[model samples]
Target: MRQALERRRAAKAAQHLPHADLADVLAPSAVPEAPVREKGRRERPEPIPSRRGVAKPFSGRAPRIPNLPAFRSSTGQVQGLYPWLYGKSLPPVGAYMGVDCLTGGAFSCHPVEWLHRGLTSNPNLLITGVPGSGKSATIKGLALRLLTYGVKTFVLGDIKNEYAKVARALGVEPVELGPGLPTRLNPLDSGPLGQHLPTDPIELRDRLAEIHRRRITLLSSLLEVRLDRKLDPTEEAALAYAIKDISGEHDGNSQLVDPTIPDVWAVLRDPHPVMVEELRADSVKELRERIRPAADALGNMVQGSLSGLFDGPTTVRLDFNAPIQTVNLERMKGRGDETVAMTLACASNWGQTAIDDPNGPVRLVIRDELWRAMRIPAMVRKLDADLRLSRSNGTIEVLSTHRLSDFEAVGAAGSEEVAIAKGLISSCDVRICLAQDTAPLAMTRDAIGLTDTECQHIASWTGQHKGRGIWKIGRSSSHVVQMMLTPIEQELTWTNERMSL
Candidate 1:
């Protein structure tokens, strides 16, 4: 009983002993204190071992990767990261137009080459911009550059004489025509026929018929512009017969004599015997009465204010051999629009003969402010025909105006004049449009088939954006460019600025 009591007392004493600490109870050694790290100096992290097997690629959702900080840069610098965000450089050929605002590369354009390469369907180019928008400068620069490549440039009617200085610099004297100018250009003058004259009787006959047709066309245009009305069918027939008679009478010993406006005027005033017989008129007076209006119109051009220019034979023949030729009409500034249109018609016909030289050097014919002539129906028809024939004749014609509405204003809505104007615009394969007033944006967009993007681009152009324009080539390709001019070119092409000063 005493031993059992002693065992119980020992067990109770063991249970009452103080509990040992956790480290003493669990750890085999004393835990060391972690060393404190210095400020701003991070402790190196322990390396983590790579997973034993390849982790399956994310299947359900993309793994989130922490995005880096955003960066800001100028366009010039950002372009390096995204090259395709800009326009591609064009084929390095033709004239150096300027820098492509989008791609920041040199932009050159060659109408003929572009056509040959199938880049454009037609070689003709149409440029439109308001006054002081650098249209003239661009054309002048193009002409100068083309001259270096042995291409000939012919400015049909420069009412402002804007091209005179450039023509002089090119070593070609400009043929200035106006009311006090001694220079006279006979519209009836036979122009340079590039092809050899035919010796065969049949061929000769056909050639002569073509010549007669051209002359009649020219005369009709002149009279229509002067009279501000279209010629009647009977009147046209009479005029045609008179021209044929006069031209036949001048043909002697197989040596052709060129007929002048005076000859046509005289024939109209007093109908030829053959014309009288053909018309079946009782007398010359009756014949004259029937065509009195036509006769009077011809007389005005012969004896009236325009007498010195067209009545006589051409005092100065166009030298197609020259690299460039300019017909300056600055003196015609004060003249009525009718007179200006008539002169333009005559000059264009005269220049056509030279431009039709297929075997000669490629020619670039520029008609600035074409709206001045489009006011006349006859002029519109002539321009339309010229645009269509430009490709066949190896000529690239550049037509420019302030707005496309100029074409719509050619005549009343739905008139033939309007249709002809529209046809001319449709024939162009390349179009360069500078900044324009808001008035004609809608018409311009519709007429040129501009897309919403292109419309917005053009609309954004302001006066501050000089030398900048939208070049639309083919059906959908377009680029914004800034025209760069050489020192000499800028001086030669500078206009209105002097007047403004």
Candidate 2:
């Protein structure tokens, strides 16, 4: 009973003050004191050896090392380590930087907090973990900390409506995401190109060429559909721009939505084609001029999607959770197909932009999946990983997928080089493996090679509790460490104050 009481008192003191010493936190108990010994019985202390030279670890014993020098406090003439503070040296272990969610208690964890704090030291961070391994919570904590530090937040979303409440609570409006999404969002379409676009003509041309080639087929498809209609000259030029590719985003990204493609599309999809004379493109020559403007218009729209994928002062949270309306090549193309294509263009564009701005302050650029846009393969596959490792952009990307082998879905039929499937995982700076049963194990093996080391790591990973995960900080290193997360308050999970001023 007496020992329990002492323990309770110490815990109470720890709750109120995070850095208090254990001895100081507990009060004296009213136990009978042991009788004092006689002077003659005094014993000399034995000398202890320095632990630095020790080879094998002494199991169950803390590693020994040379003690840090002691000091005295001049102010109070205190014979202690803290020469400036009545003094005593602070214990080496720093307090935990975690907040308890349920009780709203601030907890102290010594070594782990040291590592957690280390993440903020880098401009780019890639957090990968199984579903419950605290990845979401940690990012949230980082966001909350960043806000206090005045770092702007943006969530590039693939999952619909998930981040809306979180975004609103954090004082930023989430880019609205839902079904029947606007075929083109204007600010999203042109904003990035207007501001941070690369100035080098050669580089600009290359980027434009890369993007154009990837979507050329899709753009042309849209063009053929529109050539069936007749529209004004401006619209015709826009249509041409969309059908063929321009290397640079020379026109403002906003120019993509020519106010022509939709208008032309409206004519083609008109409820009464006889009533809408513009819907009548009776000859191939007439179709040729009219199609130019619609193509140019569609091209601008594609460029805009790229703009939305940036890591500027905003977070892009796209909802991928929606029922994707896959483009049916057999049926007529619709607005749904355009929206999906636009989403991919935005993802591809920002990913490339981040590559160009690798060391810039825009820390992380996350797009849920890189494979959904079919155009990426028959065309722009190189950009996906090239942009991933660019240090200057600090664009740490995240691809949220239920299957760990998202990369496997890509690759040419019967391609002997499995590297095509291995490419995405290989580029990631971090890989977090998570699952209840076999899914996570399978993902780890597929993403990284199914080597013996990863196999053992997965076996170990499966044993962890929720919110805990195996963290692989780099690809070349086989070493993986498990992390146990303390409860994190959703609202306080991400704070800007933790970032540099």
Backbone collisions counted per model: 0, 72
The window of 10 residues in a row where model 1 has the poorest summed lDDT is 53-62
Clashing pairs in 1: none
Which 10 successive residues of model 2 have the least lDDT summed? 323-332
RMSD of each: 12.6, 18.3
- Candidate 2's residue-wise lDDT over 1-501, tens digit each? 999999999989878847656765586345668999888897668555445543456633445555799865554345334432211221234333343322234432222222354522222333445444555655444444444333333454344333444555644544442333332232222323333546677876665554444333334433433343334554544333432322223344523321223333333222232222333556545554544466454445434432332212323433222211111111112335434544454444433432333233433344433444422342224434343443434344444444454455544555422345455555554454433245556656655555554566455554244344333444332223233243445443333333647
TM value for model 1: 0.81
Error of 2 at 450 (Å): 6.5
Which structure among the candidates has the greatest TM-score?
1
- In angstroms, give how far residue 402 of model 1 lies from its true place: 0.4
